[model samples]
Target: MSQLGTLEDLPIGFRQGLTATNLVPLWPNLRGALPHGIPTRRTRPLLWRYSEIRPQLMEAGRLTPIEKAERRVLVLANPGLGLENMQATPSIYIGMQLILPGETAPNHKHSPSAVRFVVEGAGGFTVVEGERCPMEPGDLILTPSGLWHEHGHTGSEPVVWMDALDLPLVFALEASYCTEGEPQNIRNEPDASQTRYRRSGLVPWSGWMRPPTNYPLVRFPWRDVKAALADLASVTPRGEAVRLAYVNPETGRECLPILGFSAVQLRPGESLALPRHSASAVMNIVDGAGVAEIDGVQLQFEQFDTIAVPTHARVRIENSSSTKPAHLFVVDDAPMQRKLGFYEILANEALPPI
Candidate 1:
């Protein structure tokens, strides 16, 4: 019995004199008092929100400049990060890294498709398969699944970015593989002509240049996507008609063959339903404000907010305001679905619990 229980057996007037905090309500007031008496607020705990965790992320977001200098691979959240927590997800794993310039994070490669978004950086470059591309804020780079890649900093200051990969997905499929990558120039940043330079712009498909490889030649900048949406303001972003599907520039399809990726624009207070109905998708709110509802459970999303929409979960994405548009990055195996003749069916109605 709690101290309150001992208190309950005291004179009735004795309990009345105590403040609500002094007493705990054990059962619903709907029911009469129990043999154990009322439960106290002391026994009930409060809920903590993610916003409450921001300070932790900020404080925990520290990484050494790079001691290995040439053979460096410093991960931001180390012994305290609890990376094993990601295994529970089993489908997607996301890791954030804060890399500084003048420090090369040793050249290494694994059998996984990795995507890097410049969370905070300037004039950084990533050499993938011998191709070096200029990196800037909001630029996207890919170290294709099972390909050799290395990183080198060119600017004066530090560069921090988010590293997202299909590690969990691969692990779930039991296709996980890793190894020390072959070193081409562990200490060298070769010329661009000798390697592939991702155009980050549209390429006119010339049937003669050779069939398109799974990887494409376009990098959509955050600013450009916003501008494109501004030009298309007349259209509503709700139905599939308003949704934009990203495709390979050469093939004009998703970024990669099996790994599909697209970007969408949402005006504040505006919303768009999940267009590719049955395919699973992971969306990162690049910019603007919004709420993502899956079967009536609403999730408020802002810039850099990521949400995973599992296969066949009826969902609707909405913006909370109107001044700014919500730009989002969507990744799914849409093309692969089509190739497998498994284009998902659109869930016309989002079902909510009674």
Candidate 2:
């Protein structure tokens, strides 16, 4: 009766929800849509320890040269996401990439925008659309989708960096494309000339090269970023934490089109509560120790640890040390979410709209 309101109305032989039933069998099928069942995320909270993987990464370097692997990366795969090549989250893909001395990764361009957060080394550079942007530890580099890019390291030591891409979002929308190209012999060896621009307070612009919607500056140097952070550190008002968003000088928005970057610092004994929103974030522990509690799980993270926070989960962060401050660099899909108008703060007071 009443259009088969419950799944029990079906035959006993077909009790499983996936099976077809006599009167549509709605109850079991509709249980996933119940108020308590919010399915915005498929990935669980994961902590990727750098210590466990660094040795393997070093081994990978000896095994495969840049010519063989093109890009030697150790992808961060979430256990909850069962796909073999699944993204860490539904909207982001993160990996630690390595480039050995005198090695160059083959040139390739893809439709999925990508960014790199340097973790170690120097004399490494990524050539994006003819401009050679040097990579240094703590520097952020943008290689927007559809740009011809390649990475090479001339330094004596190996260079490693975290590669963050909007591959999940691109492939999900069925708009993914990639093509390999010949490597460009672009180099500005020894010293990075780009750093000089910051001291002169002059913006570098090439009239011949330009891209639509991409940030004009490919590299955001750590030297300038640290200076800004230091300037704001003392003035940070009480009850407020220090956080700085990486802004595109051209548009004054997030640097990347899909991925957003922010530096968050919590003073000693500082605690900050973050409201739940419909975007996922991967936080790279920059320095110090802290605890980040998402939903109900408490994740203790130290330097170089990466923690993933899924959408629609309430989060609270605390600097566990009484004398040391905690710093984190966060990457998320907030830029894309804001663009699609799907971003919302779903605090405890209001339920997320279905």
Error of 2 at 180 (Å): 1.4
Worst lDDT run of 10 residues, candidate 1, spans 39-48
Candidate 1 on 175-270: residue-level lDDT in tens? 877666555543365433223333435343453277767664434454555555566666653443244555555655566545566667666556
User: Local distance difference test, per candidate?
Assistant: 0.55, 0.78
Which pairs of residues clash in candidate 2, taking residues 3 or more apart in a chain or in different chains?
none
RMSD from true fold, candidate 1: 13.3
Kindly give the number of clashing pairs for every candidate.
Answer: 12, 0
User: Model 2: residues >4 Å from true position, as ranges?
Assistant: 1-40, 185-213, 348-354
Query: Per-residue lDDT of 1-354 in model 2, one digit per residue for the tens?
Result: 233256556667767544454445446556456435466467898888888878889999999877788789999988777657558888889999999889888789999999888887888888887678888888888888888899888899989899999998889889999999887766444223354235323444642245534556778877677667667777998456588888766456787778899888778877777657788999888777888887778888888788888887777788888897777888988888999888887755432211
Best by lDDT: 2
Which whole-number lDDT from 0 to 100 does residue 101 have in model 1? Answer: 57
What is the clash count of model 2? 0
